[model samples]
Target: MATLGTVTFNNSSATSIFHTSSSLKFSSKPLLLPTRFSPKTPFPLRILRIYALSSNDIKVGTNLEVDGAPWRVLEFLHVKPGKGAAFVRTKMRNYITGNTVEKTFRAGSTIDEANVFKEAKQFTYKDGSQFVFMDLNTFEEIRLNEADVGDKTKWLKEGMDCNLLFWNGKVIDFELPITVQLAVVDVDPGLKGDTVSGGSKPATLDTGAVVNVPLFINIGDQILVDTRTGQYMNRA
Candidate 1:
């Protein structure tokens, strides 16, 4: 399918990548891509750039500041095809848009790395456009908005602990735990034979997030969900 604003890795070198099955593997060709990317910038692509890093300088989980957007390396593959110069194939997901892209690079190709760091913080509240977080140890309050945390805000729950991602000391994003337990605030009444394999039903979580749970799940039930997919895991 067509992707609106995904990066085209020009001149990539050796790297790795993951396929549709979410399994890690090595490949030299581009794979199917997500539909759309987010966060439009007013300036031209090259103007607000930073950190022109080489192909070898990045690894899985490296963040890049691409055209004023935050992108993370999901996977990469290094190819040494005899017919061509070695190249690195990599998959990138934009933090702002949540879109994934595949790019190839050789020795000269470069990507801009994002200067970011993460801090442990507790969710306090939202003040205007900014969300408030307090450092557990330092007890210092950090205020950040959409430009910082992206879409993760929807899952934010008061008193929940999370990792606040900062770029140049500015709030850029936040991450919840890998798996979190949330109370089911709304869901259809469970029926018989609603075991894990039977079927699934939509449930509204306490955080205002909706996820599919097994037929046995009911309102007031606490369930564990994988934050990465927002999918139901098991009973809390």
Candidate 2:
């Protein structure tokens, strides 16, 4: 009987070998394959692959999938005892729930790398309770509910650029710029003795977020705010 040389393929690349009675043909060029597999593909190659990472590969900002959830590594430490196998200790935060958890893994253990990515989006407006964002690249409007926006809703302003976090091609969360400048819409009048360090007052921003500002800050003043802590930074 006659046989054709082995053929191997995957989502990224493929190779084919042809064999005959006279000689063997070898092609070193990598064959281009689709990024995705079709349902009709062979059972062995039909499934998509999720990259595996060694415990030693974990580092801050690394995204991982654990217990069926996507988590970002906030901190990691390597421990090697006197007479035991090495291990990794990690603190991870869930992308969806914003919860932090401590997990340990044996050295050289395999971990699933989460398919997480971010897309640039611009805040367009609010439709009822949903906030609409337009993808900078695709120009597609993505509507996120109130809960998804959470406390960040206060910092959202029309035309503001933000980063939308995606896991498995779906939006999991969004992040605003670390600092934003907004006009103070309302605040109590400052006294004659008021100074930058004299006292503080609650100031309502044009976007409806209230933050504590130095007594010297007044209505219609443009002030910079820290989005992470919702605190007034300084005059813009």
Candidate 3:
């Protein structure tokens, strides 16, 4: 019977085995392998912001970020006729206040867009010094301070829809409807034949808002008024 011995595969044992196999092998050289080259993945191209502007660059309906507020382009025109540098005439609406203002921008100019958030809500009621509004979509109610409501308080009526503008999650201003119906509380008695001359009379509404009504308007009459121009509309 032949006896078998266990063999271990180690560096020193391999060297000893190689030495014992020297008689059978001619050389003890190691084989060389080729090196690998990995190609890098290409990256996506990034888009750069463009802010090059000129005095003649003002366009109607252009959204502008100015003075840290977002404004909508209401009207704009470029003036450049046999003069110095051209100037841009613009009328913009404050996104938060719903107020319109006229401003001039350099013909070629770039401005940042005001980062503001806005939503439509229904005017609910006033709680002491705070005015409350409910979201039209979610029915969620929010309280706003008197400062945020500003002059809009005159136009705010229960159940009226308005736009609430926010800056960094803080209520800033409100946008009221252009026209609203209000009951006349007091007014100069209308004089007959005054309508022929298209005369106007000062009238006080139930909401405490004053408007110029037609000469025929009288107290206790319900009238529609243009909130923007403070002019009276037809009787309600």
Question: Of the candidates shown, which would achieve the greatest lDDT relative to the real structure?
Answer: 2
Model 3, residue 119: distance off in Å is 1.6
Give the runs in model 1 whose Cα sits over 4 Å from its true position. 1-54, 64-70, 94-101, 108-114
Highest-TM-score candidate: 2
Over 66-176, each residue of candidate 1 has an lDDT whose tens digit, in order, gives: 767788999988888889688888899977567899977785566667766677889888888888888776667877766666667657778889987765435656789
Q: Residue 102 in model 3: shift from native, Å?
A: 7.8
Give candidate 3 regions above 4 Å deviation: 1-57, 60-63, 67-75, 81-108, 191-197
Candidate 3 matches the true fold with a TM-score of: 0.61
lDDT of 3 by residue, 1-56 (tens): 32222222333224422345546543344322232222220111122122323436
* Candidate lDDT values, in order: 0.72, 0.79, 0.68
The RMSD of every model to the true structure, in order and in angstroms, is 14.3, 9.2, 23.8
Cα lDDT tens digits for candidate 2, 1-236: 22222323332212111123545443565433345434432112322335667889999999998988999999999999999899999999999899999999999877777877677889999999999998665566889999999988888899999988877546898889999999999999877768835679899999999999899888889999999898888898
Model 3, residue 39: displacement in angstroms? 46
Q: How much is the lDDT of residue 145 in candidate 2?
A: 96
Task: Please estimate how well model 3 matches the true structure, expressed as its whole-model Cα lDDT.
Answer: 0.68
